[model samples]
Target: MKRIFLAGLLIFALNVNAQVQTPAASPHAELEQVVGLTEVKVDYSRPNMRGREIFGDLVPYGAIWRTGANATTKFMIDKPVMISGKELKPGTYSLYTVPGEDMWEVVFYTDDSNPLITEFEEEKVALRTMVEPMEMPMNMETFTIVIDDVMADSAVLNILWANTVVPVKFNVMTDAEVMKSIDLALAGPSAGDYYNAAVYYLNSGKDIEKAKMWMNKAMDMTEKPGFWQYRQQSLILAKAGDKKAAIEAAKKSLEGAKAYGNADYIKMNTDSLKEWGAM
Candidate 1:
């Protein structure tokens, strides 16, 4: 009887293994974007139109859609972000959508296990916002999501499908991070640290004298100063109204870059020297 039972189990396993399977009609897709100090990621499936109606007919109005083909669409943010002027904490969320004639409701659900919008619980919603849908001039064959119009602290999350587009605006806080990094860097001044501070001061229109001081400190700290660092020193000197010193630094930078076989830096120094009447 034990042998018969083992034989039945083997047959069942064999039948399960012999079952036919194929790839999903919609393929999986993933994308990541870095906005300032924040990292945002999205994972979803892309479904093609295939000459069928998407929004109104196949997907019907006023009904919640999975926003993708198979599995729940995932949205992940490493840091807190403000969406539509509202703050959202850092975490992963399931994305869903409710289609309408002129507008759509975008939902960010804390629960990620629900594959169908019908199964999603309203109590698990993290954020729900209504956005106007823009009609596109041409139909998009496959559903697409992109991070667009990126700036230092802001970006647009664009969703395009069929002939419609929806855009969600978000912002990241980078100023606090920049200030914290500057504080840490000032605590322990390395050669690179001094050089970066000098460059930042030069570009941001801070005190030119302070920029020159930091650049000199960077040059003094390094045993073998790089061509790029010397080039930056030259710029700082020029900004400080010391043309003679700038010309001398440019010459040194050009020679160092030639020794390092860095063609780009050599060209950069050469152009600056010519522009400053060093040649």
Candidate 2:
């Protein structure tokens, strides 16, 4: 009896430790792509055809679909983009679709909480665009979404399932963004920009005259220059073989450094002044 009880206890322990694991019927998939300066992301589940007839049978026509299985399909964009001449702001949205015989309506919804959208809420709809469905020569086993025909300013978002293919074209503001940056750059260099260019030229041994000019402009633009800035100016002047100007700038830097209690700049300026025989 004691042996039988021990055996029973071992069987119970084995049963407790046993676990059954299985693959999901619809597997989750995540896709991310950069369209110019904008980023696009999609998170959804891919359901296989499984030899059953799709479209009009498994997925009924003239009804809104969650666009995927298990969880609501999610679409995210980092920048505003134009789809079918409509603008969509940067955000995460739920993707849905309404299938027809020849056309499909793709939707972007503001609410993305529910796994399945049973009750249709027209108020939460953000954008809806119609796209013509194409028949593919070969069947696609699993549902897939891809960004195809990627260009600098636009891209085609394709949806494939079974033998049907849907393409949606969208445009990004790459040209506008590039033009804005160009305009800002052409406006003029800031004081910090001038200082950085001067320092780079001084360090790179590129045209000491240009470095001297840039450094002077930087100092002129600065209302009350920092000790570090004055130290760099002194170094640039010294490199340009202007000992008198270098000594004058170093003395000003030393005074400012002493006022700011900066030991490193004070030491640097004092050493430069001494090296120039102005100590």
**Candidate 2 vs. true structure, TM-score:** 0.65
* lDDT by residue for model 1 (14-115), tens: 998996889778999999999998999999999999999999988788888878888778999998888877777889998888889989988888988856
lDDT of 2 by residue, 187-277 (tens): 8898999999999999999999999999999999999998889888999999999989988889989999999899988888878887899
- C-alpha lDDT of all candidate models, in order: 0.89, 0.92
lDDT of 2: 0.92
TM-score of each: 0.60, 0.65
Error of 1 at 239 (Å): 50
Worst 10 residues of 1 by lDDT: 113-122
